[model samples]
Target: MTTALDIQGLRKTYHNGFTALKGIDLQVEQGDFFALLGANGAGKSTTIGIVSSLVNKTAGKVNIFGYDLDTQREQAKAQIGLVPQEFNFNMFEPVVEIVVNQGGYYGIPRQEAFVRAETLLKQLGLWEKAREQARNLSGGMKRRLMIARSLIHQPRLLILDEPTAGVDIEIRRSMWEFLRKLNAEGTTIILTTHYLEEAESLCRNIGIIDKGELIENTGMKQLLNRLDTESYVFDLASPLEHLPATSSNLCHCTLLDPTTLEVAFHKEHYSLNQVFSFLNQQSITVQSMRNKTNRLEQLFLELVEGNKA
Candidate 1:
């Protein structure tokens, strides 16, 4: 019930007269895995920067875990750990030293910081390379090291900005699992990534920004439910010369090939069973089926496009 992060009437404008955030308002509940989504130059980074105190906000009220950022700057900052999109650590520093030194910036004792650094390195699968210079580690290893450094202070709220960018799928999945575990252990996380599937799988709530405006903010399920229609691809068990007719007039079917069919239907009017039954009646046997597009990605595109209109 407690709020982890809150922003009210937030605004940011550059000296060049470009507005990056236009009176934005958002909140993330304690213990929630929340996603902040937007296309490039959509103010996602600016919002994160302000929250992390890396960039100055033109005007706004920001509260982190009940501490107002203006009056309790240290307290608010102490509760947040940010893993930015770009790597910011010293390239020449040893992997373990980078993480250990981060804790010192928060006034953590050097001995305690070293212990926490080792633990995090091991947990993030970078312990074996603890002595290696950050510049020598692979891209995925660098990413893991950044995450480890972020966790050195053991902050209650973690903000990740495209944490998996440029990493391979295997490494990305590993990072996701680690983050999921962290969230389950009560560290509220706010994630911003181009990968909508990652958001759909990891976040319970979402806020989408477009052109300096917060266009959508709600439970993920509620947002997905707002989608009126969905398309599904069904692989037929046998080849078909032409398309088959279905009873539901609300559903549209197209044949992409002899063994493939694409069905588009209003979610409110048609069920999977209805589609299956219709295909069965027409002697079409399905081999497999899948969504035509990632549900979250489809909805995100629509929301951004609709906001433009």
Candidate 2:
């Protein structure tokens, strides 16, 4: 597969002698929806800043779609559209003009800029408020505006940092759908988000960064396959007085509430069907059941904490 982004032996150090990245090597294939996940202050922003040319790297090379950042700076940047973590636009400007002016930064003609701006605004569901000042838009609308501004130049690679932060569930899911359609249409996407479920749902590949190091880079399915334990939350039809006993000794059950039971078990030994059978034997009719969406969250914690150890 063709590489969309590549970083070789990337290293970064601030003037005060703070090392932000330590010889990191990573890659994302063309048209991939990749996730870069890390806890706060874990070099994620530093890595992104360097790739987007917002921050200078101390040592190492970065290539975007095979365009070397050093020798082909304009070519490399032209291929990427970055929606950074902060809202860097002018709050007083009309929403539509903000997007059109962004295209102007890339030297796009004024006439074509308006066309692209309209297309992006409509696609992002912000066309209705195009004439409104950016500060007048809701939090979710502001987030969508940033995305529209980023895409004004129609870049093939989109880098989003906390794209859905402060967005309500309905708006967040709508943004996810738009992103899915964009990725399906052949645009490569790199996402950095605190929402684990968002990563698990949208990204095909994931890389975990901790303390300025790339610890794990693999397919999302492969990373989740490393889990030996799986957990589920079961809501009971009636109030529960005690935790139910599982036939398998490896299974651990906890009472989350009077009517909620959480079960964690070695997935290899105790199949989900077996768990259901055991519950049936105990006459515990479950009102509803959901597998914990935080499986990746648990693995992420273990990996970061284990790296410290």
Candidate 3:
């Protein structure tokens, strides 16, 4: 039940009088894998900047692991590791040096830093290129290097902003596995990504921000439960000239193709058993079935649109 991060009445305004955050409030529990989602200009980056001390907040409070950021800046910072959206490391520095040097900034001894650097580099698949300049590494390797650098100090809370933005699918999946392992080992993580599917798969709780306001903050399952209808695509064993008619008004059926059908229904009003019975009555055998859209994506869109209205 310990809190890893807490933000109260946080606000930020730029020089041009543009407010990036409007009395925002958030809390993250220890060991929780949380997702902070927003569209561009939604103040996600602004909030992160304030938390990391890159930008001064106009008003409010930020606490990291019970250390007040204002009174105990160093202690608060020592508990956070940030992997920004853009690569900010020295391009000319050797990959290993970049990571090892970060440890020094956190007061870690040189010898211990070297050992940690080697272990992280090897684990992230960057040991072979440890001596190479960071600029010489591929885009994916650069991203991995950033992650390795962020973890050099072994912070309790890690915040990743668009960590997989430019990585390929295979590399992205590998990073997902690595992050999952890190979370399982008790690191509280805050993830900001445009990939709704990634958030849905990896996070247990979600907070969605839009137009400098937090629109939704709740457990992932709770948000998903608000969705009354779910659409599914069913592949049939045999082709048909048309979709079979069903007497149940609770379900809406459509013919996607000769051998494919789409069924949408309210979760409370219908069940898979009803769908199966209807298909059996029409002599249609289902080969397979899958969701038409990701549950999280559907709810996210709904929340964003509701906020807009």
Candidate 4:
């Protein structure tokens, strides 16, 4: 597939001398759901700002569908839609007007814009609220309104920043389903969310940024594989003294009460069999056994902490 968004060596710095982004590189393939993950103050927003032309980059290159942002500004911007984290519309305006206005700004014809606006509002389950004042809508409804507004221009690539932040679980899941359908039909999506589970479930490619730097970028499966290793747990029969301070093989362990233990291990350096053998020799009876799947959250934490070091 072709690249929908290509960013090379992207960098941004604020006037107060705070570097918001540092030499970041990223690419979202056409029709792929790419997730950009990062903590607060990470460069996720700055990267989106540059791509959306909301902020001027101190240095770097951004291309939307091979159109250079600097040289083909209008064309590049035309192909992208950004639904920001915060609402940015007149509270008194009717929802329909706000959405139609976005289409107008993109130079879409009025009649066509009206049709598109209605279509999206209905598809996003907001057609009934289309005539309502923006300030009267609930948080989740406001988010859906933003999504509907962004699509009015028929953008090929949609940049969603914390899209489901304030939505209820049902609405959030519905939005995800809608986005998934959109991607199936042709839109390339770039999503940034604090919810790692959302990214892990929806995004095929993942990029993690921390402290102005891009720390990890790879397929979601590849990232999870990188974290696969030894797994063992202890079904303690009773409370005991302090456990080992650290272990070369044990990644970490937590005491889950007086009779339960959760242990994480690295398979390359240790084996569950060895753990079981040791426990057996110590006469610790196993009450049950369980295995945990490799999670993106664990890898995210490791990457962020390692970069800090």
- TM-score against truth, every candidate: 0.98, 0.96, 0.97, 0.84
Scored against the true structure, residue 234 in model 2 reaches a CA lDDT of: 97
Candidate topping TM-score: 1
- The residue pairs that clash in candidate 4, if any, are 230-267
lDDT per model, in order?
Answer: 0.95, 0.94, 0.94, 0.87
What ranges in model 4 sit over 4 Å off? 230-294
lDDT score of model 4?
A: 0.87
Please identify model 3 stretches exceeding 4 Å from their true place: none
What's the candidate order when arranged by decreasing TM-score? Answer: 1, 3, 2, 4
- True-structure lDDT of candidate 1: 0.95
- Lowest summed lDDT over 10 consecutive residues: which window, candidate 2? 240-249
How does residue 87 of candidate 2 score in lDDT? 88
- Candidate 1 per-residue lDDT over residues 223-287, each given as its tens digit: 99988898999998999997887666789999999999999999899988988888888999999
- Per-residue CA lDDT of candidate 4, range 1-309, in tens? 789999999999899999999898888899999999999989899999999999999999999999999999999999999899999888999999999999999999989999999999999988998899999999999999999999999899999999999788999999999999999999999999988888988899999999988888899988888876645566776674555344454566666676777777776666777677655665666688675543788789889989888
Clash statistics: count for each candidate: 0, 0, 0, 1
Q: Tell me how far the alpha carbon of residue 17 in candidate 2 is from the true structure, in angstroms, after superposition.
A: 1.1
lDDT of 3: 0.94
Residue 112 lDDT (model 1) = 98
Model number with the top lDDT:
1
Determine which window of 10 residues in candidate 4 has minimal summed lDDT. 240-249
